[model samples]
Target: MKQNLDLAPVGNCSVSALIDRCGRYVWACAPRVDGDPVFSALMDGDDPEHGFWEVCLADLKDVEQAYIKNTPVLRTVLTDTNGSAVEIIDFAPRHHKHHRTYRPVAFGRIIRPISGAPRICVRLRPSADWGARRAEATSGSNHIRYHCTDLTLRLTTDCPVSHILEERTFRLETPLAFFLGPDEGYDQEVGPGVAATLDRTVVYWKDWVRTLYIPLDFQDAVIRAAITLKLCAYEETGAIVAAMTTSVPEFPESGRNWDYRFCWIRDAYYTVRALNRLGAVDILENYLVYLRNLVDNSAGGHIQPVYGVGLEADLSERIVDSVEGYRGMKPVRVGNQAHEHLQHDVYGQIVLPLVQSFYDQRLIRPGSVEDFCALEAVGDRAYALHDQPDAGLWEFRTIARVHTYSSVMCWAACDRLAKAADALGLADRAEVWSQRADTIRARVEAEAYIPEEGRFGASFGGRELDASLLQLVDLGFLDPMDPRQVATFNAIERDLKKGPYLFRYVEPDDFGEPETAFNFCTFWFIEALHLNGRTAEAREIFEQMLSRRTHAGLLSEDIALGTDELWGNYPQTYSLVGIINCAVLLSRSWTDVR
Candidate 1:
């Protein structure tokens, strides 16, 4: 009964919910990914009875949970000491209907008796105002409505409404279906409608997975990672969330927690890149639209590192004292303050994802010359601020420096813009961008590189080592075999590697030293090893990282070095991206399938 990130996520890209191991709806945001948490038990600490929904079986003895293969649909079975059992299946309905994707902001649950007669109690206690109070309810004959401060949710169920409303236990005689969605009347019968939705959702996910060009090995892992990444995306606005939940600390009493429900340009770029590798161009296509809108709105102005999925500008940070933090850590935050930080590398992240549309013929809407012109605006910003001191990709609040990674990403912006121009036969613009890229590269080589240590430091004229530097080769900033790049890799390993994991850095930041190994950085190390021709070693470490994933085959942001326990946000997109990228990097090619 301990709280953990060992939860399964079910969503349709429009709405998502995190269900605990025992089939409890712990966290779910309504309206959108960044909206209010209707079920806030995940962050309620010790007092969880008010902000959760669950179906409890009397005399429960055993339980089991798993996804319905290649889909986000989850199935959980509860068995009691009397040998009676009941099965619960959960999902958010999404499928192609009426020539368009029909994804509702809804969740569907179907419960059926698997053996003998099982008695169960339906406990649906939603909260409002960040768990300050329980939502008031009004019930109809076949449905019950919970009215929160901002919105009202309707639970339409075929089960005895009185049983659910009064929290009474009932004997399971027939299958029951419950649809929690917008406060609207459902058109179809609950049982048949939910069963049909389940069938369609399963088919939709399986069909989507079939299109992916999976590796010969770890196909299941890669597919699950890909689906989880897809779930993190808000399809309505084409924005991808960093993670589903917020305020989950990086370590115990670490005070390093932040809300990750919004989209970070850098994280979204990596997510898009990984999915693109698997031939899942739909994500790339959707994300490109999001980036294009972001660029257009900026109009060559400052761009924040993160933004609301709906492109809201100001995300002032605020703490919800109503709910205690995860595990009573305190200060459960809603909005993120990092939106105001000057993360200069966002310019390159903007351009990196946009540059692909110009060349990928599979896209329904390819990049136009006008799109290239808009991107040059972003490239201009990259060139103008390439050397300026700013918050690095790590989002250090109290420190600002001329991070090498930021400058290198600026170089990449200009470098890719030049290539994009060349593809369009705009030699003049190409020359302009190419020269800017060369100038930035020369400055980085001259200032960021250390002669005595023979490696690039985290910041210009600074000697601190950072794991982000491991991305030099992956970012096209340096050749994998470059002696300088190799030296930096060695120094990072020597300084930051803790057994099978890699810490982002050893130096203390605003929250003291990082207490856990960053999951994504370890994957970067694995990629570095593979690129350096240490295939056997890389594969060994990759397997170790795989072994560290949660029971749902997902990873959080950080892992405790000593206990190997997951910390930080749940189902982190960055960690999931690492899984797909490393599998693609280390897996045998399809030619070896025989």
Candidate 2:
């Protein structure tokens, strides 16, 4: 049953869980949550066709992917050349809502066959530690265990086959086949009834998804991304991974690779908002608990910008040379070293969603108010160290710089804190925070803005344009029509645009050398343009971004300016959220489009 065996296929290293279509098998490494990877080497590897056990993708000619409502179940329909088609559904359980899915995955389950009658096959060959962890195939049963002290995974295939791909260090995915003739044959063969387990899995997602209140339009994309994000999230801890794979090059042929399996405070905040907006308080609240634990666990001195998916903020990253990277970029990395940077504004970023919880949803109770009080206490520390230089948003490896964007977000922190405090009737403290907010805002305006360039630079004493400044217009730091906002937008258009890809800033960031043009920054540019009354331009920019989705309706973190190959991880939920949110911002505006 040799169907589609990719011997040497490219893997997505940018974000985890992105399926390299050229490679075929989906790659994911999580449960680390902090960017410390559990899986590695996704781009392209030595053995093109890979797998200890093959995951048979229902022979698909017409493959359409989507999520099931509000849950994170990824559904794809595959039609074979024989016109026999099946819908393959994938979703690593989001946070355990009703205590159903145990063992919250650093890297976990991939459920298949939701609704279809195609001969289905699955080949699962998990390359642990980016293919470094040794494996001991359990005799008899079709299960293999990757030997690791911190990491444990058991993979089973539903099909009997020659598991040749798993024998050597290879790239791409190994092959497997499913013959769908009649009567759940695969189901009867496996004990405990595979059909029943699959059914329960589907029910698990369905019931969980039903708990959320979806939007009127763009509901599908939102729920899908939201759910996908949750699936990537470790259940007990609300840490959502940046992606699943490691060392997917941000720029093709350039050694600009990074792993995003860890959970970021920033991304968690976005998850909060998306959940809050979608009317689900559980995940958001659980994430708050995760943060509380994270803060409690590592609350001593300085806070890292991100944490492992399991809530460990400490991650030391190094390169693995056992396999070549996607398209020949070597030395794919496993852990993230961003744990040792001074990202003061990260507290503010984390606090934003908490602020939203306080102001917008009111789901936060009185004890939550106490939580704010403690968080505000930390704000005092930030105020004391605000003027000092530190790593900016990108968390660069070099010496910290006076990143204006960090300062700007720091201002936002105070701004949100003041408002939240005021709402909670702590007006006196609010006033003090408000005064500090004014100071930060004044510093951002005075120091970050380059009047000569007619835009804001990445840092104080620097004169390069940044995409973050575009948020000034959206976040209302500056009115969309203000001279400064206009100037910043123009400068971003001039300097930051790399074809369709846009950089967060023109200057080099801390995540290693900036290579691929960032995709979400482009979304921010569109949001700025739309908010600034340039509706058509925003629409055009948005269209360009939409056109960049892979053969799958997914996006990567960045895009190569030349090959247009998605740089970074595949199926980035943040990028999709950007596209969905921005599209909604444009299409269904409450205000008139200028």
Most TM-score-accurate candidate: 1
- What lDDT score goes with residue 332 in model 1? 85
**TM-score list, all predictions:** 0.99, 0.80
Candidate 2 residue-wise lDDT, 1-594, digit = tens: 221111211111122244332223434443333332333334445353332333344445665555444444345556556665454444342333365553334222233334434554444444544455433334224544444324545444443433422343222232222221111123344423434343455676677668766545445555555555555556555666666556777776566677776777876676566566656676677677777676566554577888876666568888876556765577587777777778877766666766765665545543357777767755765666566688777676676778776776677778888888888889898999999989988887788878786777777888766677776665557888888778778778877887756787666454445767788888887887787788898878887777766544457788767876677765565686686667567665433433
Please list the C-alpha lDDT of all candidates, in the order they appear: 0.93, 0.59
Question: All predictions: root-mean-square deviation over Cα?
Answer: 0.8, 6.5
Scored against the true structure, residue 477 in model 2 reaches a CA lDDT of 79
Local error of candidate 2 at residue 408 (angstroms): 1.6
User: Which segments of model 1 are wrong by more than 4 Å?
Assistant: none
Q: Give the C-alpha miss distance for residue 370 in model 1, angstroms.
A: 0.7
